[model samples]
Target: MFTHFEPALMKFLRDLQNNNNRDWFNDHKQQYEDNVRTPALAFIEQMDQWIRLISPHYEASPKKVGGSLMRVYRDVRFSKDKSPYKTNVGIQFRHEVGKDVHAPGFYVHIAPDEIFLAVGTWHPDRDSLAAIRDHIVIKPGPYLDAVEHQPFTEFYEMAGNKLTRPPKGYDKEHQLIEEIKRKDFIAICPLNENDLYQPDFCKMVASRFGRAQPLQKFICEALGLRF
Candidate 1:
């Protein structure tokens, strides 16, 4: 029984962008829970069921802490701009064995100007990266077909940084060299703010992810895992 996202969710995010401090967040914690957090958790709960229907190998945790809901707190210890909170809501449905963003996963990013639905591995460890590149080298047809599929290509384009030169062991002139040289294998479909206002937004998003299943499955197989 999911409903449209509360309009206040966007308002809260806008406010957070302006006032990215703990004091401001503490003052508006209730709004965060009622307008943003609670609805987001409900969406995640429903998404968990929807995702399982597509593939039992993937999971969406509804927990407030370590679940799919990314923490609002920004890790500014290493960064120069020390904004205390993120101004967007991020939800990820990832492989059960995946520990972080590195694992093959699907993502929903909700923001004022940069909303999108994405899938793929981001910054994988050395071993995982090698596995993916090796797989692309051996059998690139499926990967090519998946990314170039009209339905998928209509919405998403290949994303993330790529190496200028071919990686070690990969041919510089290989047909799939560009894809194999990618540091992250991700695709994103930009979204409109109005899209979140639909009552069937959850199902709509799930369908988009479904269309990308071939790519997800391929990435999983390359990593020696189920999709």
Candidate 2:
């Protein structure tokens, strides 16, 4: 019974971008709840069912706090631009074993003029990075198939930071040396606003995730995690 998100979600975020202060957000909190949070939670709830079928190890939580829907509040403690709230809506259906954003997961970013779906680990720990590189060396075909073949290739493009030179152990002449130089194992697909307006939005997401399963499974195998 899941449907499309209303246009208000983007409208609210755009407005928030202009008036990013706490007072402005507080005044419009009800609108946020009604148009953004509520719809987002509903989407997550439906995705909870869809993700189980896609991968039992993953979760699409609908909790008000500490769930798939990321917090609206921004942690500006370390940065100079102390904006109290984030202008974008982020939803991550992370692996059950993952404790933080660095874990392997499907990420959805919704914002005005910037919308995309991403998958895999972002900024993984040193050990995890090494393991992924090792896997790429040992099993290059699957990696190639996942990226070069249909379904996955049709949707996503390899993204994330890359090392200018090959890593310590990997040889520069190696076929996948470029891939091995990656600091992140992330892939992303750009999405349009009309896509979100479709009634079968959840189904479309599930389909895309299924297409990316081979890549996810390979990463999980490398990390000794179930996909």
Best by lDDT: 2
**CA lDDT of each candidate?**
0.90, 0.92
User: Which pairs of residues collide in model 2?
Assistant: none
Off by over 4 Å in 1: none
RMSD of each: 0.9, 0.9
* Tens digits of lDDT, candidate 1, 94-120: 999988767788999998779999998
lDDT per residue for candidate 2 within 125-148, as digits (tens), equals 999999999999999999899887
Candidate 1: residue 126 Cα off by (Å): 1.3
Assess candidate 1 and give its TM-score to the true structure. Answer: 0.98
Q: At residue 115, what lDDT does model 1 achieve?
A: 91
